[model samples]
Target chain A: MIFDTQRAIAWINRIAELVRADVERLTTLDTAIGDGDHGANLDRGMTAAVDALAEKEPETPGKVLITAGRGLVSKTGGASGPLYGSGFRAAGKAMRDEGDVVALSDALEAMLRAIEELGGAHHEDKTMVDAFAPAVAAFQQAAGATADMHTAAVAAAEAAEAGLAATVPLQARKGRASYLGPRSVGHEDPGAASTVLIFRALADVTAE
Target chain B: MSSSANGGPTPPSVGIVLISHSAALARAAAEMAAALAGPEVTIRPAGGTDDGSMGTSIDLIGTAVREADSGGGVLVLMDMGSSVLTAKTLLEDLDDDDAPAVRLADAPFLEGAVAAAVLASTGADLQTVAESAEQAWSMRKL
Candidate 1:
């Protein structure tokens, strides 16, 4: 089954709920390495995104994502705002109106590249790219192997989790956390943690 | 361009936008920059989220950019962190045909805004205003 507009809307709504539940956790992680606003920023952004989707009821999965992205940029109020917002818009524009498994794979990569372009974060920089890049790679590999949306989503989520875990041992090379140098090594990057949540939300929605 | 009946070749003033993470800070800086410059020049403060919290808002920045441009290009000066990213995102969205082209000035926020404002008040072009703002970094106090 294709991941249609409803599925995409469900994914964002799920992300909003997940972010709301994990706000304190995200905030704690950010506080350890960055400005301590990750949780609140994402929560507010995702919540607004969900509202936007409901109001606009975009005709296609891509339009839904673009609308959600606009909401995030307008309300997230942090670095993640533009980073994640731009990623979603790029992904949406790449997908256009299509929502096939192949489109999903391409959209994931597009989102990853957009984030990299916006934040200048690369793999192993202990930012969201750590989680996002691996997730896209995993999804692409899985989709190329099976062309199954659920399988690809699961693989992406697990890869994102592993990437998030790896960030705990890394010295941040970018973002506000980089200001801390080696002192940032012990904490998991908040951006990576949020990326994990994002993939997990996708996997959960795909499973449904 | 038609010259004013009385004034001689009066060029349109370049617009200035100040972006910061803090709402109060950006407004205060705008106030200072405007004071240094004349009141006729438009200097806008695009700061904080819509709900009055810390962090830059893309919507706010977009609106400020649109409002700042007075047929003369707008010069944007941003504080550190996401303010730069937010402004950059908006700038990327601007097309070549967009009216009153916008340029981001990579200079100190307060000092750059002050310098840019002063120069803009002189009816300088966008490039010159941007250069003046960027050059403000060299004005280090010994």
Candidate 2:
């Protein structure tokens, strides 16, 4: 199933709902090694994204993502805001007018690239890249195998979840968590966990 | 202080923008730096998220940078983590022509802002102000 503009908006809104539901859990994950505001900040951003999308009702999938990104940047504070905003913005640019499986793969790849470029973080740094990188890879591989968007999204979501879990026991090398050094080894990265939710939302939407 | 050649109000040679996670913290730091820099320097506090929560805002920082600039340039002093990321992202978004000669100082937030502010108040150029701020990193308090 190819994702259109409406579908994309719905997916993002669904992610907002999921994020709102998991706010406390995400904040708990953050409190262990971070500033403990990840969930709240992201919830604010996602809520704003949904509202902005609903108000503008953009015509293309790309436009919807871009509007959502802008909303996040403006509404969400902290490093995550700019990082995630850049990712979504890049994905939107990469998607252009195409909503095929290949385009989705390219968009996810672009999102990862933007996050890395903006955040100066790489895979295994115990950042969102941990989840996003594997998700992008899985998406690209699945896109290569078939044209089914749902299949690729499922693969990506599963990879992201695994990556999120893998962040535990890894010492943070970037962000505020890095200040803890060895103390950060036992906690899952809040950013990576949130990334999993994003991919999962994508998969859920595509499956529906 | 020297007025403009045309007898108009003269702006400082450089401006300072303090980026912090807390709005009140940024404002207080800016005020402290302003006290040291005198009333000549344009010191703007671009802190917290848009809703006055704790976090850095790229839009707020960008706006503060523009507001602080008075033809000399702007110097950005960030607290840590996301503040630095947001400031750099804002710079990347600016067009070359509209983008001033802005520099993000890798110095201690309060000390750096104060040092940079004082330097700019003395009619120092943008580079000199930024260098002075960076010099604060080496200040030993032990």
Candidate 3:
């Protein structure tokens, strides 16, 4: 059985809340090289998107994500905004027609398209793409092998975290970290770090 | 919290808009807002893309603003640079009834989210809430 709109919303909410609790830490990392609002900006964007959804309460998962995508697009004014927005928009597109279950492949395709269309960045670019790419690929592979969304989500979350950790030694090519050159090497990509949080939320929610 | 849908006597509930250049930032912002905002206020985020050609489409953003405003005012927050232009475009796209009085938030991210939520919870108008957010952001060192 696949999770539906309400479950998805709950997952998003949990992720948002977890990130909110850590906004200060995230921004501190951003403060080192970037504008320092990474955590604050993301927190604001997610909060706003959730509020919009609560007010409108779209009946379907597609509508919910679409509403969220639009909200993120307008509210977040940084590099990550459109990428995340487009990702949800892609996910929404895939889930436009729903049954009892949402296929892992459909979710993967939508998220990949969203990242590609919005950021124009690729895997191993030392951005969130680093984490997202690995997570999606792992999720797809796991899902293909087994029809368990919960297991797939958990595997993806782990892969995402591992990918995020791997970014520590990689050279920066995207976002503000690119400007820092060698200085960007040791620090974790904030975007990748946050994506892991999101995937973890999804996994936890599904497990429940 | 009690909120009035457009044209009500109570100070209209504030609406939130987030503008960022990063998809991760946008996602993170949306996640933050949900944690802080109460049930009455409406928050929406618009993410920017890295491609110079790609941006938050004004029409699409305006629709969200209009929908959230519901005859109230909207407080828009942007990360930097082009986000200002993007917010302006979104405001221009609003229809008469759909468009609420649009205010640009001063506080960057956390500060803005907190201020917006406080004002929204208290039934502050878009302009006042936005002004407060700006003050909070401007005074901040980082």
Candidate 4:
């Protein structure tokens, strides 16, 4: 249970930074079949979200995530914004009035629900859900085995990375890529890749 | 030319709309256009949610399409299927009186964006610019 206001802020910043760092790579991935702006749009949205957070830091972790979600929705101006926004919004909803510290299981469940509700994507959809669903499940499972937040975060990040890699072989069932049908088969989903970056950053911040 | 380069009258004005299945993807497209267009152009966007919610109001998008059609025409760029369908619906939603005469700028976002931006910079009216965009797309494909 490393879910404090500070940890929340760190999580937002970490995700933002990674998206910012990998914008072009993600864009290239998107160019394979879908529109080639996933990286650029996501980075832009996260940058604005971070800036908003800097201007007015929230007192609660939930508040911070909510702010991040809305900013991405308004500033990013695309499918990714709403989907990611829904993810943050869902997480925030789960944490409502839950005080400063939340169990790792709680965080995982919140995020998983957020992704599902927002993206309307499923585990095998070959979207970010592919990475997120597995990662959260792994994190939750690991949390039951260990009381260490760092360990849970690390495991979650690893699962997310593996999930992203797995997307290379899977066919996309959702999003613009889905239109291409079989053409979408080989390309790694940029959304999943960007998602992995966010989770990896979370692991970095939560790692003790 | 030199004086204008140092202190030009002002740049042309452009509006942007990003259409995608996910609001995040639309936002990403708008963000890129903003970077390329600089601070001067007004960028507008409409997108769907992760769950496939329409990104912008159909009425509002109709207005943008109409507005673009006012003089030259409107350039509509679409990302995916529903976006195209929604854009189509937006056009169809318009009453004859409410509708703005427009052209669908059929091009990849990157090329269409550049075309739109350049046309705007040159002060081409929306219809003319949109026509130019469509033409550009046609030529590029050829």
Model 4: CAPRI class? incorrect
For each of the candidates, give the backbone clash count. Answer: 0, 0, 55, 25
TM-score each candidate: 0.95, 0.94, 0.61, 0.61
What's candidate 4's DockQ score?
0.06
Error of 2 at B100 (Å): 4.4
Model 4: residue A131 alpha-carbon error in angstroms:
0.2
On residues A119-208, what C-alpha lDDT tens digit does candidate 2 reach at each position?
888778999999999998998888898878888889999999999999998999998899999999988999999998999899989986
Residue-level lDDT of model 3, residues A25-85, one tens digit each, is: 7888778766786786678668878888888787877777777876766566565666776
Ranking by DockQ: 1, 2, 4, 3
* lDDT digits (tens) for residues A70-169 of candidate 4: 6775556456765676567567767754432235457557867766764568876788888888888877777778766778778888999899989988
Could you give candidate 1's per-residue lDDT for residues B25-135 as a string of tens digits? 999999999998988689999889887888998888888888987788899999998998898888777876865688999999999999999999888899999999999
Candidate 3, position B106, lDDT: 51
Top model number, DockQ: 1
> How close to the true structure is residue A144 of candidate 2, measured as C-alpha lDDT?
90
CAPRI level of candidate 2: medium
Encode model 3's per-residue lDDT on B1-142: one tens digit a residue: 3435774556557778776755466658766776776666777766644322234445445655676674567788877644655564455445576347887765767677767766776777777787777777566465
Best by lDDT: 1
Who is ahead in DockQ, 1 or 4? 1
